[model samples]
Target chain A: MDNFDKIAVIGGGSWATAIVKMLCENNSTIGWYMRSIYAVEHIKRNKHNPNYLSSAELHPEQLDLSNDINEIVGKYDVLIFAVPSAFLNSELEKLNESLENKVIFSAIKGIVPETGLIVGEHFHQLYNISYENIGVIAGPCHAEEVAMERLSYLTIACQDEKKAKALSKKIKGRYIKTKVSDDIFGTEYSAMLKNIYAIAAGIAHGLGYGDNFQSVLMSNAIREMKRYIKKVHRMKRNINNSAYLGDLLVTGYSVFSRNRMFGNMIGKGYTVKSAMLEMNMVAEGYYATKSAYKINQENGAKTPIIDAVYEVLYEKKEAKDVFEKLTNMLD
Target chain B: MDNFDKIAVIGGGSWATAIVKMLCENNSTIGWYMRSIYAVEHIKRNKHNPNYLSSAELHPEQLDLSNDINEIVGKYDVLIFAVPSAFLNSELEKLNESLENKVIFSAIKGIVPETGLIVGEHFHQLYNISYENIGVIAGPCHAEEVAMERLSYLTIACQDEKKAKALSKKIKGRYIKTKVSDDIFGTEYSAMLKNIYAIAAGIAHGLGYGDNFQSVLMSNAIREMKRYIKKVHRMKRNINNSAYLGDLLVTGYSVFSRNRMFGNMIGKGYTVKSAMLEMNMVAEGYYATKSAYKINQENGAKTPIIDAVYEVLYEKKEAKDVFEKLTNMLD
Candidate 1:
């Protein structure tokens, strides 16, 4: 129906910038809300995000960059929240009133700290919006690839099939392909859970485990993901789906994966603090591990991989010791 | 119920050797039938298969190797058909009389060359046995890894869940984990279809398409796989399960996969003949493409990936041209 005239993207991160660039290709005006004046000024001045996607240039003409959250949210019909999970709540609180009629979509993939609610749920609660008004762009997709004009696919998950389809039509293109799914909770949960497994995969790699072990860890992670997602959401998730298993495999093993790289460093005897500091990027898995561990404990869900990751990251267990513990759990 | 004692593995391939080795680990004598005197002599003398798994050292004390099919089949209680798809019928024909009351499992993955029947279906017709007697091992696994004693998982499919579980317990070990599924045809079809997609993935890689496009191809391949499997078998297969989608993803993308590696060579400017000659191994996709194309034509199923792979392999279409055609087809 071409309902969304202007798409509002929140955050100046790699993923948000990539989405805004893709949406701009459709000849639609994009409102990008960045809290940092430096990010907004850089996009306005250099017409590109030098920090994350330095190679691909962004067109400043197509973008309406703003530091004021209210000004940005008020300009678009569809609002895309691409901020980190930790910042989602505060960002939504700033746009609470403006979010009423707009179709809000969360591109963030993590559970709210301590609350264990998904980003979409957090948005719905703070904004006082119906679930139908909320959609999640969950996937086996990365913004870095999209910036390179690489083809990627994502699942547009919403309980309302009509809204999901509508959003799918808006974002679907050559560089980005979108599939419609009814299981919003399952999709969001999968996106969140995979980060935890990616960290675990890194830890395994760091422990001198080879590709064979990494593949096995991924296989087990998918099973554990299915179990945890099913227990919490009461929805049937295909552990094999692109959003769940596919994402896990790629992120768990790919050289481009920061979480895996971070984990590998930890596996190679780097302290968690040093690894994170050296990465100079937040490996979502670091935060996701603690969040997922808490959720698993509260829900009484059995997630051996998540437990192992939490132990390695927080409980001060050695990466090799964690690998030995996980290997023993396999039989 | 530990139903069988002596296990007959009917093939001299990597998978057959690996299964024989696993059975040997449990202190069970394995009868392996091989048609080649060279292979038989090699297995007998060096106690290793230099063809499929060069790294694995076979223990001669635990295995009985023979070129005589009758001698191998008559003595064993459980028979595993690990021969190539092209050889399954003739091999089964030789062991038909001995197949009665024996647990016959297919480690092969492809439809029959001319008949277009799944190996299990051919066995059902040849021996006049119920489908219950036929078992198909579908996987997110590889023989090379299994031979290396790497942990792997597989799905044992049959119409009878009780029999499936019983068989699973018999074959499963610390390294080889097995699960049971009632959707025998769907699982079988998915296993064969994955080889075709692996070829497509290889072609994509050869075309210099990045991981983004390859991931999309894989995602699309899973969708196409689910559609074709469901259309032909009419069973409710969880497309996201490890048996279906998981197997496809691993085999389609992994460096350890022969089919993918073979396809990769073709994608990287090697001819099919050259790729085959270079590897000095059978790329199951090369054979599977023809059979799957024939089956789709006969069953009125839509398998664009299979059709495209068939066209590229048999029609002699340039790898880049096939990729261009596939991308356009998606549009």
Candidate 2:
């Protein structure tokens, strides 16, 4: 096994903290870079990420923590980006060092708002990273569950099977399991698409639809996801696989999903602006829905769920009326 | 359309009551028969099923209720059997009337214990009913949801598309939507198989697995169901359809599911016998697991979920130990 030694995690979100926690189990000196100097200092002093995943005890001795983006990017053999898709551009703008040789894996689950490209495609198109050197960390695994040491599954996808397998070994632990897939585009797109579906689920739930309807909505959502992904990246893959349907189920059904929370408020008659304000953060799916709707204009897939979500979020339609129209479209 | 008039519901359970309620929206003088004479009299007097779905009002003026099975079977053109699989044989034993001419549709979600066949197959093999005459009503629906008048979806499947469509029209109402399918065997098998998976889900929850694990288990289950159904009956069908995956989700995730409740108790360290004793009722999945395990032995589909449930429920294996082994089998 060709072990790529210095692996660094970028971003300071809950997912980043969680990924670093997983890497800590296998790697001795894991590199962690965040934009926040205070978070870096806090972790070094308090032994945990105070802003996110606070309950997860971190080993400061095992970490090579820094806020300098260029230093970590230059030193690391593999860089795993966990930043929100909306802010990924600004974080990369601070980087003066080349990413040509550094293997990149994204834990982000949305299209980059600036370019309307998935993180892997963004790196490939702009940063000139080869597809083999780029990878994706897709999750049915939630960061909160990881913090609780609960059993969770992650999919490591890279065109190169060897690199995917190597990364899988680094993340697998007593409570975490990893599967490797060559369908990087499919996995990444499914991960981004599921959040939009989760918002649809939350809106239906908030509109007084019961569990029976929710189950039907989810069944339809997975099929819609399969159709949409196949249009973007044609692949021979099972849509029922844990990476695709499993990821959708966890986000759509989980009470802890922020996208669902945002959608719930929208369904309860709050405008998109009000819902975002109430959440105090923008959901990844909000950007994903807009980008996906635009992409589907060229790559046509019958995406009723996505259309309903987009109409409610960006078009500023009433969630109740949009969802009412949606019920007829689903099986 | 070939309309089959004089539709009758044969059972006194909650499902039978819900079906009768759906029928009442389109049909007048719906035939209803049960072995319980007191319950039949109570419904006639109270205008509702006193024992089940008590909240759903029944119009006595439109119903032809009887305790005599022959009277209802002899008069009705279409019979929807909603009896428990265990009691189905006994229910048929009470009828001296021939069912060869009647179009039979089953709402039962288990295999016949005596025949080790799904309800549709059981009726076909033993009762000499033609495949075209036999049908299935599969659901992502709950009887409780119907009682509450919540929107729910149903799949009406028959080899005869006309029969399926006609029956779908009879059942479709303000709160219920129906889809027609021609895969009677697959839908009926999926209905029975979903119970076993629900038990697997319950055992996992009982043994301390979280939502992440449950999502993966369900995703794996739908794939396993697709593989298993294909082996038994070779057909072209989307396993992600509401009839398959939607039904599984409703049964697996519902709080009202007795199978889950039973499995939860077993996971909490209650013995199978003790769990049954405490509930004072046997879960349909308990019988389903045994039958499905036997069927799979011949079919040769890899079913770790069903096997694990069987070991815990029938083979007297510990829940923790079996689930520990199961975790490794799932992705």
DockQ per candidate: 0.23, 0.87
lDDT of 1 at B319: 72
Q: What is the Cα-based lDDT of residue B232 in candidate 1?
A: 82
Write the residue-wise lDDT of candidate 2 on B1-331 in tens digits: 2557779999999999999999998887799998899999999899889889999998888899999999999999899999999999989988799997899999999988988889999899999999999999999999989988899999999999999999999999999999999999999999999999998888888888899999999999999999899998999999989999999999988867999999999999999999999999999999999999999999899999999999998899999999999999998
Candidate 1 accuracy as lDDT = 0.77
Error of 1 at B158 (Å): 5.3
Q: Write the per-residue lDDT of candidate 2 for residues A70-171, one digit (tens) a residue.
A: 999988889999999999999999989988778999999999999999999999999999999999999898898899999999999999999999999999
Q: What local lDDT score does residue B264 receive in model 1, on the 0 to 100 scale?
A: 87
Q: Find the candidate with the highest TM-score and give its number.
A: 2
- In order, the candidates keep a fraction of the true contacts of 0.16, 0.86
What's candidate 1's i-RMS value?
3.7
Model 1 agreement with the true structure over B221-269: per-residue lDDT tens digits:
8778877876787866567677776678668868767788888898898
